[model samples]
Target: MNPPTSTWWTWLAVAALGTFHGINPAMGWLFAVALGLYRHSRRVVLLSLIPIALGHALAAGSMLIAGLSLGLVIDHSWLNRICGTLLLSWAAWHALRGHRMRPRVGMQTGFVGLAIWSFAMAASHGAGLMLIPALMPICSALPGAGGAAGAAGPTALIAAIALCVHSAAMLLTTGVISLAVFDRFGVSGLRTKWLNFDLLWTGTLAACGLVQLAL
Candidate 1:
């Protein structure tokens, strides 16, 4: 059966944001490509994605948990305001200093190091915070989401499903981009055909904040 229009849109937004994050080089694909090139092995590129996705999932899951916990205490309207303000603030910071803030990991780094870098990158980029808007409705649908009562199980189950869907989308997109770059264009492709995703991401953060506030 088809989902309701609202639910459909929410899922779509989740997937769309994941895709957007995937496109951003800081999210992992570019690093994966670099590692593969440095090691002179396509297999290395494929292997890197696993830890990258795992790290991203960890960051995103933590944010969902935090948002849910806050929802239990804060009024919906105030939560919106707070999240919106955070989004805007993050946007401003990302625009002005995000490039300089990237964690430096050497080419010889191990899987665990790569995973840690991925987690830090995702967190710094506010990748998880972006999901709060989509998450609100799902949590809100529960009767006692504003309380700690019966809402915990259902909210957790739904949040996990949502996080899985989002992470899968991000991993798929990141893998495709990583493989394409590794096999065909190589790192030189970045210099020749780089898209300024930082600017786009900053605008998106601002838009998310405005939308949340407007909601």
Candidate 2:
């Protein structure tokens, strides 16, 4: 079934956010290219996409689950306040101390390790919380959308759709960017430019936090 016309923008926004996230090097492509370069193979870089996508999906999915749960227990105003508080707090932590809580993978990282790292990075950055406002409406539209006890059907469905759309967009971008970087400028180029990305990530995280508060 087609989603409501009004909600079309929301889904588009979801996809857009996915694309936006993918563009950020911290999300996956940068690391994947580095790994490939370390091993001297393009195939490894391509293989890296699977775990990257999986970890990102899990991280984003957790937030949707949280949103669904929050709807059942609290009113929207409270939810807004909580989300805002959390986002701002995370931003503050990152600003003052940096992501010390971020997971560290060994030089010889496995798929599971990479996935864990991705989840930690995504969660600490409040990637999922950024989508909460966009999801809350659809999650709360139907009767018991929060599912008094079980997962609300509509909430689950929409969250799944959002996750899929976001993941696909992210994966596509990550693959393309990874390939381009590996083929053209080379992995060293990614390392040279990474410092700038660090600054951008911090600013973006803080900006998103402020946006959550505004919402």
Candidate 3:
């Protein structure tokens, strides 16, 4: 089925989120670069993107399931309010003490390990949770597209598209950055940045939450 003309903004949000996640080193790109350098092969870095995206997808899909479930049962207005509140709460928690929430990273994890790590890290960081409001707007817009066996088609399609777009963006960025770091200046290049990624992430979280609340 074709996407509604009115849904362009929704699609843009999905893609934008992907690009945003791609830019985040914690999303796995930095690790991929490290893995590449450790093995002295770019192939390793490229392959690492697979499980990284998979784990990210699984993490995001979990929230998609939750959003879909809620969309099917609750009124859009109420659902929005709930999501708004949740986002705000998460933002505050993250901003106040995001460091303490980081999942323990494994030092010896391989491909599968990387996938699991990505999933755990993304989930713990509320990456999926951040997408709820964006998805809810589109998913809830569909009338009768919830709860019923036949009702999920449109929402499912959108969610699937979002997953693909996000994964692709993350993979592309990971590949590019990993390669650049591998060939150019290595990890030291990343250190040139003065801004703290965590603080930036915290601010982003808060901004997204505020937008959700305003919506």
Clashing pairs in 2: none
Every model's Cα RMSD, please? 2.1, 2.6, 1.9
Tens digit of per-residue lDDT, candidate 1, span 50-70: 999999999988987787778
- Compared with the true structure, the alpha-carbon lDDT of candidate 2 equals 0.76
Taking the tens digit of each residue's C-alpha lDDT, what string does model 2 give over 5-93? 56677787788778878888888888898898888889999999899888988998898678667777677667777777776776677
Residue 196, candidate 1: Cα error in Å is 1.2
Question: What ranking of all candidate models by lDDT puts the best one first?
Answer: 1, 3, 2
Task: Estimate, for each residue in 1-215, the C-alpha lDDT of model 3 and write its tens digit.
Answer: 85455867877787788778888888888888877777888898888899989999899888877866777766667766777777677767877777786665554578888999899878867787777767776675675755645557777777788778777877787778777878887787656764577777777777777777677
Q: lDDT score, residue 87, model 2?
A: 69
How much lDDT does each candidate structure score? 0.87, 0.76, 0.76
TM-score for each of the candidates: 0.94, 0.86, 0.91
Cα RMSD for predicted model 1: 2.1
Best by TM-score: 1
* Residue 134 displacement (Å), model 3: 2.1
Clashes of each: 0, 0, 0
The TM-score of predicted model 2 comes to 0.86
Q: In candidate 2, where is summed lDDT lowest over 10 consecutive residues?
A: 144-153
Q: Is candidate 2 or candidate 3 better by TM-score?
A: 3
Candidate 1 lDDT: 0.87
Backbone clashes, candidate 2:
0
